[model samples]
Target: MAPTLLSSPLQGFTDFRFRNAFQHYFGGIDTFYAPYIRLNGQLKIKQSYQNDLQLENNSTLNVIPQVMTNDPDEFLFVVKYVQSLGYKELNWNLGCPYPMVTKSGMGSGLICNPTRINEVLHKAHNESDIVVSMKMRMGYENATEILDAFPILDKYPLKNIAIHARIGKQLYNGPVDLDAFEKCISGTKHKLYYNGDITSLESFKKIQNRFPTIDHFMIGRGLIADPFLPNMIKNDTKAYPKNRWEIFSEFHDRIYQQYDEYLSGPTPIKMKMLGFWEFFSQSFPNPQKIVKAIKKASSPKKYQETVASILKNV
Candidate 1:
């Protein structure tokens, strides 16, 4: 059974470098989605955003580009640009929940208006001769929000519909409402994919048993906290970290080596590691103190030594 494991795109966590490095040692994820790019309604990509989408930066990884825009023109422009990069698939992001994004008439806020979604999908399908997909939440501010929009979404030629099973306001809090996922199954004819709160092996088992036929699952923070997560799922094996520190050292070293080669200096390196611990601390021993020390680290050497000390203590 080829379980279609997919690496979920976390804005700050999963990227070309992270996906590439993870695939190098543990190769289970079949396809990866690049973090959503905001088109700014200007038909222009920022330098940093361009760096994120560059084909050269991701030759080792198979990535489908994502665009977060409500404007049909901006959306089409971004999709066309990715097509220029030879990407055959484009994912629309109606899942983002930030107030800054929503208040500006994008992301989950866009869910409040189905006519807008219908217009954009109609435009994209008519304009772009490429495969288009969508990632969305159950609603903008409530679970029932998707109910009103389901008919419109079902009308589109969507390759897949990935649902987070929560409202925009929920923002990664609480358990995913499987009841709502059931609603998605009931409401739409689009092929469904699951994407929320799939962290441990046990949780995944529940999903697998419940949706025995589901082939695609998206994982984010969970994978960062445990890099072996995809491998564990693929083999249905448990990770026994006896040589815990050694494993930590090896993973850290590889990630850092890749980062150092690609990033400019200490500040960038520090930023990446610091952001990583937000999820990494979950599996670490005495995580609070270790994360504190890591946060307090003044130099790259200090950061490395601090990680070493924490692992040795374990």
Candidate 2:
């Protein structure tokens, strides 16, 4: 069977502008998980998060709204907000490994406390009919943390639990624990989705081979670094299209124009694209050189020129 490819949510990176352009230019992702809507003690959703989940904004693609919270009321609030936007499922984010989030007993930090996990899930299930799914790291400090939480997770009727195999402490640095991931398949009754280090066709196949039962796979940073990767993997081809760079350049321009229009100043757009280039540069021969040139681009015109020059060589 062909694998189902999903675009994993990257907090600052995979917003609506990026998602729309990616879907239009490169079509392979079966669904896109919107970056989690974080309600930092406020019951109100941010306008930016509101814009991302607007039904008209995502009409062309399948998008699942996600939330990052340790509070049940916050979970229920987001659940109502997404359901009102016509999304049927809400993906809870317990996978984020950042220090600020985890330090607050949210994201991966909350994984260690199954009782709290139960509290949030318990309220969400009791109050709403909206489907609930999970995005989780194996644990915060260690892999076994999830094992302890599985009993609590299994009590609820979750759509699925997508696990990024490394523990929270490792962040995105170490190898994904395939052995531990394999254990996850049996650890719960819920269907499991594999995520982490799936950066290439070969890597996707390796994970697919190991966990033949898992059909859903999520691609995060890899999708931005190589936009054509999902399609190529789906088609099982190593070759790029004859106009690979052209398509990429066009996609780049579309996003650049939109971001420039929406953002007030040159610096903001430059920094935004710079965040993207941190991944984009990896596709080139000299990633450091590409990043350095982009960083040195102090103005919009200079940024465009730098991008053109980088693409010109490829």
Candidate 3:
């Protein structure tokens, strides 16, 4: 029942490096949206940020670069910048619901001010020479605000849309508000994409049953929790102990090895492996014991041994 897989943006987590690593071994995600590029006043693209999005890199695959700003001019600036890299489309961030972004009149904060979004979208289209799309939440402060936003977005011929199934204030805290999502879907006239807590195949089926029209699904935590998610979904695979450990190790060891090479210092590797454990914990044969040793590992050498020990158990 599920549609194609999309890798949702998870700010600190789904940067280009993470996306590439995940895709190399686990080929479930059909597309990956790079983390939003937070632009300041400068018209110049920072060296570090540009490096993160270099098109020459083979791992870029289906990566789409995201730009975060409320200014119409700034949006145009990024469009030209991304166009230079041969990208055919641009996705705007209107659904970010954090207080910091909202206070600045960006992200989900713009949902409350439909006129402003309309003004920016209109001008951005006039100036932009590339296909532009949008990613939004139901609303920032209230779901009704989307009503104000819909009339404007309906005017633009976007490539498509990706919407998180919640409002800004909710911020991935509780269950996704499906009722609100249905309302937004009904009110708008644009192609829609579903983005939210699709953590497993079971969850995906429920979405398929509810919304028979959906052709794309954007997943964040579910893919992170299980690297083999997309592969299993595509093949309709069940957990088989025979091939499970091999696939899991190939995914785990590849990423861990890369992190070890690039990140120096004791805590970098530790935090990364620990961060992975949040989802990796689900795959361990004995979750408690593996996680316990991983937590106790202090030095690089000790960390290496502990991770090896855990993977062996898997």
Best candidate according to TM-score: 2
Residue-wise C-alpha lDDT for candidate 1, range 1-314, written one tens digit per residue: 75677777888667777777778766668888889888655778877667777899888888988889899888888878888888899998898988999888788888878999998999888987889888889887788888888899988778998888778987778889988787777788888888888888888888878887577888777888877788788888886546655765777788888788878999998888888887788887667876798899999899989888777776
Alpha-carbon RMSD of each model: 1.8, 0.8, 2.2
lDDT of 3 by residue, 17-57 (tens): 67777887778788888778778788877765686678865
Q: CA lDDT, every prediction?
A: 0.82, 0.93, 0.80
Badly placed stretches (over 4 Å) of model 3 are 285-292
Which parts of model 1 are misplaced by more than 4 Å? 240-247, 261-265
The count of residue-pair clashes in candidate 1 stands at 0
Query: What local lDDT does model 1 show for residue 65?
Result: 84
The digit string of per-residue lDDT tens for model 2 on 141-163 reads: 99989999999999999999999
**Model 1, 223: alpha-carbon shift in Å?**
0.7
